[model samples]
Target: MPKAELGSTYWNNRYISGKTGWDLGEASPAIVAYFASQRNKDAKILIPGCGNAHEAEALIQLGFTNITLIDISEELVSTLQSRFAKNDSIHVELGDFFEFSGTFDVVIEQTFFCAIDPALRSKYVHKMHQLLNKGGKIVGLMFNREFPDGPPFGGTQKEYKTLFSGKFNTKMDECKRSISARLGSELWVQFDKI
Candidate 1:
């Protein structure tokens, strides 16, 4: 399918139809470990394409004060709005990641980068750079392999390095704490905006 076809309607339908095979139903262990090591509980953090927002919940538990979540699916965002209504620390918005505007100390990437069309990878990098404050970092997992064709599109570390080189400084390695299904296939990346 063309990249434009994978917009909000497509994603909302996926959520409505229960086709979200990518939903892990809980926070990712690697991300959780990274958050636990952080001393700053008040960092302004953004999680774009934040489906179900498991990481946001994990952040709340860790005492994070300013968490923002944006997703293309209105259905998912509605649910998130309701879910986080009582928590002032978390903000939920329905919008495209590329169009959303914000500056954050940290951006948590999970399956978001893979969910976009491969053609948009460069745009994704730029948007990430724009969303982060100076010295801000993007931290999380990216698939270290390929898919047939996907919302869970996969990529290699070499490609990722080249893609991000001009915009950020990166540290990537095999993720030791990935869930069993993704173990050895996930790369834990920390990209600091330059």
Candidate 2:
């Protein structure tokens, strides 16, 4: 099969056509479960490429006050602005993740990394390093299996290690037992800024 086009236009069209298969419709179980056990309510959290931002809502319910969400799609961001209008705790922005600037204590990655062009993997890692404060962490799932075609590009543990090593320390990069269907072939990763 030929690879599908996957640029800003492609992703924007996906949002316009409501073809967002990546949206879980709720906070991811792995993410919710992980943060549920934490007691910090003041952590500076960021969720780039935060489509629909279900996790942001969940975080607000958990009493986390400082949350920021960024996405490149104007349509999605517009919808999100309205959806979160009454909620003052979240800061939503429409922008490229690479050019987004901020310091965060925790960055949540869901489907963001896989959605980017595979050639930008190094830039993604570097940007993550730059966006995080020292000792800050990024925790989320990553595709552990290779897709025959992608945007939703898949990767192996070795590939992730090579991509993040030297720049960050791996706290966890193991299979997530509670992932949704079709995502059984994924790994949960937690990278701490070195």
Candidate 3:
């Protein structure tokens, strides 16, 4: 159950108004480090809620050929399509994350977790389990603190661990490579689908 109607209209308005304070403007340093260590540059990677698709840009720069970027905002997706128009290695889609389907070797969880309604946390975990290959992992950062109100919702390591328990061999800890502004407040998560 959703507390508010946090749908495409809500997100579109956010983008249309430039209220995206959560857009790190670039890929998270922690995610970049994870990508740097991956030997499979051609591995299928998906970034849901891919505002600005910074990680895709970083992935392309690292020679990764298969990357997918999905977001619910038509306004943002239009911008993304233009940004990567010349790059066939990147494919961008405007749609809902839960209903969007694909198999991915690595699903970069950049802000997607905290951005959804808290009630959907379990659903998100289930969807991740379904989308991943057997050894697939969801990597990147999650805010390990609470917010007064959110779409940009926040929570602690314990809650996340419990939510992802059973389905994923989870690793949630404070992110050392997070940008200075989010440092100490974000958890560097690496959950391998079980």
Candidate 4:
């Protein structure tokens, strides 16, 4: 597919057709554990490329008060807006993450990074830095292996470190608690904006 074709329309159609293989049906275990470990429940958090937003639900249940979710897919965002309409703590926006601006204490990364083309990796890192407050963190998983074809583009720790280390302090480890399908293949990353 052409790079341009991978924009909002491609993703919206995925949602429209229920082609979301990336939806884990619930919040990712590694992410949930990280959130559970946080002492502050009111930290400002952002979840970009937030399809289905299972993490938002987890955050709400954990007493988190400020959360933002963004997705390029109109269909997905519309559904999420309605799904979260009655909740005052969560804000859902339909837009591109690179263009969306907000300062967050924590940004949750699930399958979002891998969903983008690999060539945009540097842009993704820069945007994450822009979206964070000083000492803010990005906590979640990244695929540790490669895929033959990808919407699920994968990368190694070396690449991730090289991409994020200049702008952030980075730590990565095998995620033992990953959901079965991703077990052993997922790397839990903590990238702190310096």
* Best-fitting candidate, scored by lDDT: 1
Question: How high is the CA lDDT of each candidate model?
Answer: 0.93, 0.86, 0.89, 0.92
Clashing pairs in 2: none
**Per-residue lDDT for 1-194 in model 1, tens only?**
57988999999999999999998999999999999999999999999999999999999998899999999999999999999999999999999998989799999989999889899999999999998999999999999998987867889999999999989999999999999999999999999999
Rank candidates by lDDT, best first. Answer: 1, 4, 3, 2
* Model 1 misplaced stretches (Cα beyond 4 Å): none
Per-model C-alpha RMSD: 0.7, 2.1, 1.3, 0.8
Per-residue lDDT tens digits for candidate 4, residues 114-188, read 989888899999999999999899999999998868878788898998999889999999999999988999999
Residue-level lDDT tens digits of model 3 in 62-100: 999999999999999999999889999999999999998
> Which residues of candidate 4, in runs, are more than 4 Å off?
none
Deviation of model 3 at 55, angstroms: 1.0
Give the Å shift of residue 94 in candidate 1. 0.6
* List of clashing residue pairs for candidate 3: none
As a whole number from 0 to 100, the lDDT of residue 141 in candidate 3 is 87
The true-versus-predicted C-alpha distance at residue 180 of model 2, in Å, is 4.0
TM-score of candidate 4 relative to the true fold: 0.98
Model 2 per-residue lDDT tens digits across residues 2-59: 2246556677899999998888888888888888887888889999999989999888
* lDDT at residue 18 of model 4 (Cα atoms): 94
Extract clashing residue pairs from model 4.
none
Order candidates by TM-score, high to low: 1, 4, 3, 2
